[model samples]
Target: MARRSYKTELGCIACEDLSLLGAGKEGWLVDNPNILCAIDTHSVALANRSTILVLGWSDSDGSRLKIRPELSPIEAEYVSAIEWLVFDEIRVIVAGTSCGYMLIYSLRGDLIHKQMVYPGRVIKLRIHGTKKDLIQDTLSGELCVVTPGAIARFDGSDIQNMLLKWFEETHAHFWGLKPKRQGSEDFGNSHEKLPYQLWNVSKYGNCADAAITGIMPPPLIEVQSSQRYYCAVAIGDDAVISAFRLSEDKSRSLVGTILSKVVPATFSTISSLSKMIWRSEQTSPKKPDQKPQSFARAAPLTCLKDHPRKGEKLTLSPSGTLAAITDSLGRILLLDTKALVVVRLWKGYRDASCLFMEMLVNKDIASSSSKYYEPSKSDYCLCLAIHAPRKGIIEIWQMRTGPRLRTIPCAKGSKMLQPSHPFGASMSSSPYVPLEVFLLNGDSGQISVLNRTLDT
Candidate 1:
């Protein structure tokens, strides 16, 4: 029989060697440093076990920041996850530790903030943001911190607010422009502890990976207008897929209860002069301290149990409506989050890594448009790039309903990488930048971009 052949339509170009600038000068990264994880965007951040090197792509010879996550002398923890966080104009690097702490570092390598999110080890940090229209006020974003047994969410606006306050206070102190007031020593530390929602997703099994799919709008008949609801999805053993509906706790806090009783007692005392018996009870000077609580409840929505087939990874769509999950049985399942149903499935892709990407399908119309004409969001079509190591090929499949577009030969031990969303970038303010994926060859120590598309 003749040997089968593959096409070269999906090709990649060589990327710059990451060990060329300051990192190379300091002899920190070897010729082929065993990169455990990395994120490529405006800058490239490569992490090994303990160190992370970040540098910009615009200037090859520019300075690079080498960061080592600070750990206590008694604690032994290493970096588990890393992501670039954008707060409006300010950008920072956030790294998760094995001991369940989130460390935020400035671009200059200073530790900006650190907090213990969970008792269990942090599995991953996922950030999802969307802009429905061009005239939206700000991007609706949420940061999901995943652990073995739970997941936590930090609203984008809350983070931005906290960071802004911390920076302003630090600037004032640095310039000696602000007077030292009571509790000034704890000013910066207290500001970093932003309120977050946590949920226990361990009901099915330990979560290997999870994502906050989307935040649902409140119902018309809802009583609490301020409470926000969310939908979360997780994957692990015993249960291949599990989803939960997360909402804030409805119970009143100690402070709320105390204030409520005080208001009624004060009004009664004013009306009835004989109500002096309750005066001593309400005259206490000390207030009850609020302890750390989950402040949220997770109700099981659905559970898909598939024994002997554990889920390894989860990739969410730009809109978070769909999820692509890979299982141990060498299959990929496309799941709809809102409906909680598997819409598509592909088998025979063992050890396959997948990422969601976009391709410009209507090139003819794009070319025919005027030079200044901006292409709308509809010009591009969503696609999935599956890098199958066993077959040494990278296949592009149109998301849910389309056929496989093209298959490109790839080397073994190669992995596909996509830059995280353009954090803090407004759809109306900045020009549209289509999402793209890059190829990283572990054997060759070479990086390449997925620049070509079949268009059809």
Candidate 2:
């Protein structure tokens, strides 16, 4: 998909109350006012009416809305976090906590499956695109290509060898495993050869019985698969943003090793990643006749947003150009993905603890003849919104200029919304809203949405 670079208004159709806040990728418009808020991403689910208390959108047309889901029943309330996974059109997985149980529900409100994943209260729950056939079957079978057996069959030893090669090529300190050393010959030798053993469990079965028996035990085959497929890992207090891979081949392996982290700025939470752009830089040679030396930039720039409670998450734009980050103080930072430098920062009034941040790019903004404009770029025209905690105080800022663009006050007669504890914001390149702000409501489990109107 092409990168977006313009901003437009999104109209709001409905609002809903949620006990706790969460974000999804898909957009939604509900017909019921009691429903209050609706968001659609990989999956579509609604927060119970009583639990959700606030809703807000960045665009006047309501393209993006934030909803906070109510907490589970006290007996089932061990779920400390909730997350969504949109696998294709029909399969949306809502993974949340139910005390000791890690519940996985479908978008259709059916209990598909549940597992006892963790021992203590479930702090966070993240479900990335799965490699399981069942999960793939829901997403149009594309994910089936990622099965361990399939990866082993297609990539063979080349995948392992590539990772080994990458480790060697990127780092100068190979712990005496350099090609110049004789011992280095065995470095990737195991990867080059597949080590699998097949055994016939019923090899000695009675011949007469085997012929009479309608069913016979099949041979047991064990594929000694390499462990190179551990490409993605989730890190944080609750593993909010779990990383996964889309490819297994060596040439594309680095791309598959994306680090996905969660942004906790807004209730409409999302994950982002950073891509490593590798280029060779030549150094001056000692002598004119000597060849210039080249060096590899091993560390790619990383982008992460602040978490509601602690830590941060990282995300990559669809076009891989901009990296967004949110800080614990409800501050949003945008970075050049390739250069790994901060290009812009957006801060709201008061700290935006547990608020969400999104990017809305207006194509018209790029086409405009403004000296600060560039049409060919994506994610240039960005808009940010937050569900403010204080009454009559919603802050919105332009990322490029770092200027406060608008501030929307809370509705009249509404109680001031305040965060139970101070936290930070997160940023991303989704083009939905540059930032979705939120304020936690003490231990009451309520959140309030603030709309910021730019002061002309």
Candidate 3:
């Protein structure tokens, strides 16, 4: 007989109550509320509509850290997404609001910096970073802010430098020393605006969600240039999957285009010309003379075959070569990010959520020397974990035609989460910290972790 899979080797279960936030509570019309959550090594950020709370990973004292954003009294907005940002031994919470404002908060619940990213609602904020090799110190990272019709990218170095300056100034005040700039209280207003590259991705369809999958290599016949092009993949209702090539050349907005021809370029500078026609598109109060934002033109790339059902949620693999998308019809489509093609599909699993995970190749062996075990060659494999709510099971299946490995019975209101690794870290270091998945029980407010184990 074939050897049985080690489903029984799932190890070291733990739980923490989460009932106070009312995250799992359900009603007649609203079965699943739009609750946003992000996890780091030591803390968890949970947002239920407007209120946001941060709790210690395992604090017995039950202390809650609440972030209070400074908002205008005239307009109201709610939180849409939250993520933990780690750079240079500092950890902070980054939150996006429905009114297109990005806010950064210190762990002590003070707003560090705020910026208006877009005039429309912010859909998602994705942070992607990578290194050339394990030994090399050179690294690259970017923050992609996605909206319905456009996408913008902020360089990682830009954000890091801004945070460093703020922290240094704050420290100087603590020591009662003369600081070069204003104190932390005035820093927020006088903060410099971070320059970003914007792209109009509304060609294929309005983007429900999107990400910068990877940077494409230049073509053989291409002219030598300093600017690098990027590939952006988007998901929507009309078109299930779409992609675009983002160019560096600036594209004029409708208002900007009309005024450019009427006004002489020699008479007015680029910044002055843009501000003359740039109008406020948002309901939030703002000065009419605010600086105008610029965007680059997006060229259409290959699009996946149109599907009747719309995609609901998307998750990407660690390498970013593959993406798992769940749809309205209870099916999951796995796509090759580089090729822009669907490689695999699964049906009959409605209202499902999927996440990419890694499993050890050799499950029978045990490493007893220490807790920090260095993995050897051919040690791990990529897998997809699917949470099927109708069947009340969490299924782990091997990727690219591999067989199902485990079917775990989970609670009805549970959610699967992938822990965010520290920013600016090397991908080679991942082997030291084996990839794992977390489970949050919405009904009972309990948290649990699932780890691989040898036959006991």
Pick the TM-score winner.
3
Question: What's the true lDDT of residue 266 in model 2?
Answer: 23
Select the stronger candidate by TM-score from 1 and 3.
Answer: 3
Tens digits of lDDT, candidate 2, 1-456:
674322222323233233233322121222222222223321123343323222333343233223333345655453333444332222323333434333434332334334332223433332222122343332111100111111111121322333345345425445544444223223322223222111111111101100000111221352443322222222233222222221222331221222111112221232112112333355547432211111111111132333452224333332334444444455555545444456876566243322223333353553456775433324443444443444345455554455655555543222222121101111221222323333322223234434322211
What lDDT score goes with residue 171 in model 2?
Answer: 53
Model 2: residue 253 alpha-carbon error in angstroms:
21
Give the C-alpha lDDT of model 2.
Answer: 0.30
What does the lDDT come to for candidate 1?
0.72
Assess the local accuracy of residue 305 in candidate 3 as a C-alpha lDDT between 0 and 100. 46
**For each candidate, what is the lDDT?**
0.72, 0.30, 0.71
lDDT of 1 by residue, 1-456 (tens): 664343222322223544432232322332333354555554667776577777554444345677876665556687778887775678777788888888777777766677778766778888777774565566757788899888888777777777787678767877889875344334534544767777778889898899988877654565866777888899998789999887776454343344446655676677467446455444447543233344356778899987899999999988899899999999999999988999999999997888998876777754564777665677779998888878978898887889987787887656677766655677765456777887655444455667534532
Q: Once model 3 is optimally superposed onto the true structure by TM-score, how far is the C-alpha of residue 431 displaced, in angstroms?
A: 6.1
Ranking by lDDT: 1, 3, 2
Model 1 residue runs over 4 Å out of place are: 1-35, 132-136, 169-192, 217-226, 250-292, 366-371, 443-445
- Deviation of model 3 at 378, angstroms: 4.2
Candidate 3 contains a number of clashing pairs equal to 2
